[model samples]
Target: MLQGWGIWALGGVQRIGRAHIFLAHVLLGLPGLLLRLRLLVREMYVVGVLSMLLIAISGLFVGMVLALQGHNVLSEFDAEQSLGVLVAASLVRELGPVVTALLFSGRAGSALTAEIGLMKATEQLSGMEMMAVDPIKRVVAPRFFAGLLSMPLLAALFSMVGVLGGYFVGVGLLGVDEGAFWAQMQAKIDFEEDIINGIIKSLVFGLIVTWIAVFEGYDAVPTAEGVSRATTRSVVYSAFAVLGSDFVLTALMLRGE
Candidate 1:
């Protein structure tokens, strides 16, 4: 019993260590980030089409909530019509990328892990190696592109849907003046830079999530339990990486502005 417990602990530590090391390796390949591409359009379609529904639905609901909450709080200060600015700020800066990334991580990241793990288990990857095809370039490259492309599209979708939802609650539901809302938003916010920042963060998050999932699956052992463990780890890592990178990117973008 003691030996078994000791081995389990050591295995946990080693898995963690390897995961971190793998992340570091990917981080070091920043220069290759833009140029790495395979099945670019196909990947984009997968990322964009498959993930759009969730992003749209989530953004719609979140925007409504934001309008409601902002109305309640800002009405106290007689700044009720500033709802547009509030909605725009939350959607573009905080919620847009974060929510979309979380959704994508759940759907796309798990799919990537399972696909790669299955390939590994079936020795399809080995066959590719025997055929002198680089599995990383073939598999990872397309997926990385797909994740990256989908992120910006999803971020834009989130921003648009969130804004519309906020408008619905603020103008239609709350009976606030629509013009006043947009006016305040235009005057108070830097829409250009903030949108760019949000999109950039989303792209980074997508890349990180897919990379972690693919890496784990690629290295997964040929066992059902091992594949399951990798999938779980992919999700946990996806969430952590998305959130952590969001904070870092937000700070850096805001600091320069």
Candidate 2:
């Protein structure tokens, strides 16, 4: 049993390695991505704009919850006014990118996988290949680039809205001092250290999520059952990858600092 389990684990690792190489091939078509700017923009609209409402709603609620809980803690120490710093730091340094990536995995990532999987099931990708067309260049590259570009913007929007929600809860409802809230946040939240790192996290998440999504769709068995399975796997795998990578990145980014 132990040897069989070990063999299974090694096989899984090899499959993952192969998937990474496949993604690298897709990435090599970066110039083709630029050449297909129109398609890329369309995908951006689908992946970014269509997903904004949910991101906004989730961000607001998360911020509000953070403020409520943070105020409870800080008030005990007579530091209620530091709510701004707490909320802003939490959102910018961690929650913003992580939550946005999770949302993207559910909304845009699953959509990409399902769309491509269905196309594969319907023989569209094969038809393109039969015409001497590179499906990766024409079909995958634009969507990949769009996801890569959209994640940071979505994370920024999420952080901004979350901050606003925190403000509403902390200052409007809880009677925390408004000026102290904003001022403390502005004073402590370094743009380079906090904001830029958050953006970097979002970008890395975008690459991982999209790569998994498209690869699952492309390699899925060309059947209805296969397409459905691939779509589910894409979201699950993307979520795990985002969370796992976030831990490693946070450790690296904060090391010796």
Candidate 3:
């Protein structure tokens, strides 16, 4: 049993090493993505623009829920007026990056994997390769960069909308002091420590999610069933990667502070 466990651990490490190598190749090809600016823009429109509505709605609702729940708890402690600080800190520090990443993994990341998988199934990628065109440069790289570029902005918007939602529920509905809420939030939330680190977290999550999406699609077996399976794996893997990385990043960032 101990030997079996050792072998399993070794296999996992080998897989991680191979994944790192794959990521290096993909990243090294990123300069070519700039040459395919038109493709990148199109991907941005599809992955970023189309995803905004869902992100906005989710952000707003999440904030409202947090405010509602936070109020109930804080009321018992006679600290309901601190609702803004609670909402802002929670959204900006943790929820914004993590939730936005999960949503992006489901929405844009899955879509990316599906589209690429379908292209592979249809032999589009192969045809490009046979024609002496590098599909990774022309196809995958643009989508990868588009996801990376969109993520921080999406997370920022989500945080902003969440703050508004919190205000609407806490101040407008619950009649907490609006001035105190905003003031406490401003006093507690630091620009560099909280906001910037959150953006960094989003950026990292975006890279991990999109990397899994594009790589899974690219490596999928060239069959309809394979495409379907790849798409599912992309979402599942991206979610796990995002959550796992979040814990590590949070620990490192907090230790730095």
Index of the highest-lDDT prediction: 2
Instruction: For candidate 1, write residues 2-35 as lDDT tens digits.
Output: 9999999999899778867665554544445456
Give lDDT tens digits, candidate 2, residues 1-257: 99999999998898799888878878888887777688889989988999999999999999999999999999999999899999999999999999999999999999999998898999999999999998888888888888999999999999999999999999999999989999999999998889889999999999999999998998888999999999999999999999999999999889936
lDDT of each: 0.82, 0.93, 0.92
Please write out the lDDT profile of model 3 over residues 81-165, one tens digit for every residue.
8999999999999999999999998999999999998898899999999999888877888888999999999999999999999
Candidate 3 lowest-lDDT run of ten: 15-24
Candidate 2 to truth, TM: 0.96
Q: Estimate each model's TM-score.
A: 0.85, 0.96, 0.94
Residue ranges of candidate 2 with Cα displaced over 4 Å:
none
Clashes of each: 0, 0, 0
Q: What TM-score should be assigned to candidate 1? A: 0.85
Which scores greater on lDDT, model 1 or model 3?
3
